[model samples]
Target: MLITRRFFPYFVTQCLGALNDNIYKNVLLLLVTYSQVNELPISVNMFVNLAAGVFILPFFLFSAHAGMVADNVDKAMLIRRLKLIEFIIMSCAAVAILSQSYLVMLLLLFLMGTQSAYFGPVKYSLLPQTLKENELVTGNAWVEMGTFISILVGTLSAGLIVASDNSLVAASATVVTLAAIGYLSSRAIPALPPQGKIEKIRFTPLSGTWRSIAKVRQTPSIWMAILAISWFWFLGATYLTQFPNFAKLHLHADATVVSLLLALFSIGIAVGSWICERVSYGHVELGVIPFGVLGLTVFGVDLIFAIPPAPVDLSTVYSFSTFIAASQHYRVMADLFMVGLSGGLFIVPLYAFIQSRAEKGECAQAIAANNIVNAFFMVTAAVLSIVLLGLLEWSIPQLFLLLAALNTVVALYVYSQVPEFAQRFVSYILSHVMYRVNVTGREHIPAQGAGVIVCNHVSYVDALIIMGSSTRPMRFVMDKSISEIPLLKYLFRHAGVIPICSPKQCEKTYEQAFEHIHQALNNEELVCIFPEGRLSADGDIAEFRPGIERILAADPVSVTPMALKGLWGSYFSHKGGHALTTRPKRFWSRVEVNIGETVNGVELGRHGLHQQVSELFERKS
Candidate 1:
């Protein structure tokens, strides 16, 4: 399995890290549970919640420095050093456990948070460097699955172990053992160095943070993606922190029941993450983002309804088996699973998009900016939960619905601001509906710079399909009559398509079109023209027009020949004297766009170029 060799070590490291984190955290919660001062004026539960918030605060303050370190140093070495730091932190945690010191435990929690903050940038930024572009979604999926599974195991084990007779010893042994495992995994990771040179580390935390923030802001899409990621964490933190209370108070369950709910949630996320890699076909398909948001909105509301009303006299001894006896418990579990699935669909794409599009060598910094925003959002969630639940007397179910509605508003706003995400949605729909487009000899088109593309026009949407496939933008020349088609005219005009009439019919229109083509080529822009000067009347190659030769003679540029096949039977094709009718028996049509060798303008005249291009098309057909 690809997960075994390439992803295992990273997975092990993440799992161990999460295990250590939760073990130590649950031990602290256990201390609060058993505290002699639990009856004090201030709520012990509130203090525990505040401690959780404080742990994430470091990410906001220090992520910039963390990003710099990840960018400057060897990544494997950095992981090794971070693992050593974990060992020290876990040792401190052990001491806190042995001594039963809340102060020490709280301090150690801060230290653990610091370690995680430092690792955040390196963890995400390393994926793009190590994995191929095609492997990114799968690699991220495995990582996310490992992280969540660890959380489930760690949360469950911590509750069971700390509730034992020898709580201190159990906690100490668990943390130290996990820390050792983490270190071993770090050792196994192959060496990966910073991809580029590093500048001097910025010591001013605020300034460094602002600078990192500014870099992301400069790229609108990156900024939007960061916002999306931040919101995910914010919503997740709120839901996760509330689960234990919800299971215990609302469902009249116990610690084991809470653990079971957590397990289901984690498993759902893992399953969803794994599925995202497959559904996306290895690319960061933004089309999945809306679907994810839809699921989140639907399942989130269902979770509120799924929760049972407060039980009279809640039980403290509910086990996993006993919890499953209640139908409401199963309903809650199903809701959590759906939530996890939606979250998986949402997060994987955002991370992949950020990795793929961020400025090279500054990925760590960009991710660092995202972490900072995420921390702020988490803080907001914490504060909002406190005010709404604690002060305003809002029920947990009400809060869940509010969050769901908020998700809809936020998703719409983000999609409106960045049309690329929506554009991908359109492209995805059109590609599947129109036909499967196959391109051959695509490498013949230069990766960079301008070239004139001459092809035999086959259908109305031919340019749209080609535009969708071509990595570089091209200006197309279309017949004046077709260019006036209502909806298509808008798209054509926006795309800078030039309209040309036959020279015999409208000589001035023909001259103006040629001038526009000339200007486009001189500006080093790709310009595509139909050398047949008209669509094929009988689905056969037509005589070549000399207009291409005239354009080429004016500017000596390489000419790329292309053909459109299977489009002959498309809805827009001239069939049975009705332009709008579809070809019979055409449920799934196969269209191929084949590009031929670049013909030297100086060597190939109009007729020679036309013959070569036509033959290439016939061969491809």
Candidate 2:
């Protein structure tokens, strides 16, 4: 992708933009923090916050309009225009830095934020337009990695400039050069013509925001995803906003060490983003959300405990090398790094999910909605920081601890609201942790419209494996007994699992299960049924039941036959004995999910479907 014409230039353009933003923003922040300017009308703490809020405020005000513009125009062309604006902003910013004008610098920050607001929609919207479907997650991961890498470099650059003899000259040159290079990169991005036909004579921020949010709310998952991503930004803004103060007051560190701590965090996120791409295996996998949330909460709280006692001398300020030499300091560094690593794991998938799921014409609006919500959260974080630290006098570590606890509540609510995340968590554990699932012919699953997937029942978790393998959601057909199992029942119910039993066992369940299947098919949703009916007790496919034909007869939708091989004898399977009752035979076994071509239900009756599945199962095994 780095060498690809469509991706590389865009990547460079966005990354350079991120770098220039951070460089200019941090230079202003560090000067006010360490320089102890006497001209400030407010307390240093309040001014620091005011500066941060000034930069974020434009995103809230202009994002809706920006999103509207991005959807209605050529995104590549718009990006080039935005970058030119960015260059102009940076050119003026250089003079402000050289003159040491704090007020002018703050105003420039707001202008920089305005450019970023417009750029955000175009930057994210262009990915789906330029890359292949499979490349979405990888693409997001790479961009995230680059963004953080640039952030760390820019942060360190700010520190060195401030420490230099001619601080003004160094700061002036860096932002201007980065901005100029970013503009050049933007020019190389291939044109992405507008995908939507909606005509608007002008951009309306307030109305556009409300309407974009309404459009986003049309899909529950996307709406929740936007909230999740916004929460991430809120949490991120808190930690970043407090970092300089956290370093000075808590660690007794200088400006260089502040940059050092931030560098570690940024590097950790970049590394984690790379790992997330590898973990996803070319799919927009959301299973990692729970995992990311866990690490985020865990490490964020541990950071408080990891902070060592401040040096005996209040005046003892440590240089970068002195700070790292101590063992306890390592814990604080590691904790911050893990927090960032977890964050990287958390955000990439949500970006890809919204991008892939949103309508092509409305993708920019969706991203714009995300930006608006993110701005609101970040500004809230800023206010909360002020109330707690300024009004209440809580330490930075205490603030960090409270935020971690809040993360648990927020993550629980999100998971509870969207059980598919829980379902994916189960899938992630099975496929990535318990077993390595290799899927083939995934393209057989209909990209759109109704489809029925029939697989041989090998284990209790076949539905999960099938769900994980599918790009779309699958409403699985399960046994009545299995559906009633503890813990699994709640999961099954929310996941739209259809539970059926023999007519003699329970006529109502038998009838209702088929009814649900028909209803799901009519909605053009994917439905998966295990034709073998029950888990194979002897590690072989039971004779395929004819019930599949009965369901297909009602809707006659495209029937895709798939096989699950290498699942027999697993802890979940009824291999050698009852399922989950024996010691696990293998910890990281491999399973194969081979999906065959879709066929008409009327043409391929139960036997033909069974034959196709059996051939795929045997051929793969």
Candidate 3:
């Protein structure tokens, strides 16, 4: 339903374009293998790889120009023009297919790549402009879902069509027809105003590429997202490029079986993408990424062991059904599916985050930089595959192991750089999986700038639930004893949550908490303090502590009052007894956080702030 008006046409247009691209690509590869075109004295393997190379080469060469044009002109009109170019290229491809001209086909592939290179930036940048802020993650989900599904259909169609005619006529027809459909769909896309003005257009490939990359690097978060996205592309390219050969050589399966494996992978990604929209509640939840990468690594490694030794008589081909007849073989298929599913979860958030976080007017250019990096990573993956499989004589299974291990390293590095990813994930698990969290007046949370968030402390897990609900990250002030909880110690530290104690208990710790709070406020960061200084023994508001006065005196920041209702009797609360000692009564209980209007720092005193927070929760009660 959300896809009806503007998003649907764009989705169809993008899906058709992806389908045509893959159909043309797989058709060329199929032609090299099955067609008797011996025009040039090159090995079929070399030509197949060459076709792949030509398709991606334009990304490195023209991405900067594409990004600039996307930002400088009307995106809808640009898309229409790009679709027209695709139609013409497909027409030329049809002619090339009829003549069985390898050189001409390769050239047409380059032209198609050129068209896609230009479309790439426009495709991603258009979302933030056309859709509402809330729709971004879901929109990205649909787009990614469509892209992979198209890949599945295209690969299957190419395999079947080429094998049937011993010629690419059907494949050619498919691409050309899809191109026309894409152009028609493009016509329905509403025009969007250019994001930025381009005073002049420059086409210097190397320097322009560097400039674009440099622009993205200015925002560390966006740049890291780009790198993570590129890594996914690298993993995807390695798996996809090897599927046909992997099926034949590793599984002793026929072309149809290869298509079947690809179909499983594609379907897994589509399912995962669709699910991401539901689990994230329409926001770009960085929490989903860690779960995704964890699955990616775990299953990727499992795939190494799932692969059985090759059967005798490697020339024998097996059907899809026959390939799955063995239990071990089915496990391999499952592993591939899980990898794809995780891949979807890993990429959609990063794409959404990039679109949301990139400096205004530079979203297109940032995505273009991402495209450049993605292309490079894919190319590198190809080379790495060759080195490991060809020169090092490592088996494909071993390569899977190496990739899995490398993914773990990358995941750790990324989480270390942006602890928010892991922090958000922990919050996500607590709020979504362990308990259901609902929030009212969530808009009261400031979108930007510094403020002090004051909430009535209800439970040990209150901070985690609130973190999951908030759009922006906040550093909470917690009791020093609670910070000693083994499971949460690392998360609290990484989230920069300040821990304090009473002056009598530890004067030094109490003093240090104030310093941290002051620094956080000065740095334009959101700092949340309980103000009560400890969790309530009874399920009622405790006396507001004087610590709030000290914090306010130190830094006169806006005070936002939030109430955590329904968390009074939760597992991490002292409802039955001390938290962790008492048995839980229920799981997945509904918890509501009601945010009230922000009070000016100078106007709201400690007693007044407590009264305000109490009234906010009392109304909900």
TM-score ranking, best first: 2, 3, 1
Kindly report which residue pairs in candidate 3 clash with one another: none
- By lDDT, the best candidate is 2
Question: Best TM-score goes to which candidate?
Answer: 2
Candidate 2 — number of clashing residue pairs? 0
The collision pairs in model 1 are none
lDDT of 1 at 437: 66
Candidate 3 TM-score to native:
0.89
Give the winner by TM-score: 1 or 2: 2
What are the runs in model 2 whose C-alpha is more than 4 Å off? 29-48, 94-105, 162-170, 196-202
Q: After superposition, how far is residue 526 of candidate 1 from its true place, in Å?
A: 9.2
Off by over 4 Å in 1: 1-7, 35-43, 248-250, 307-319, 327-331, 432-568, 572-621
Return the clash pairs for model 2, or none. Answer: none
RMSD of each: 4.8, 2.5, 3.3
Indicate the worst ten consecutive residues by lDDT in candidate 1. 423-432
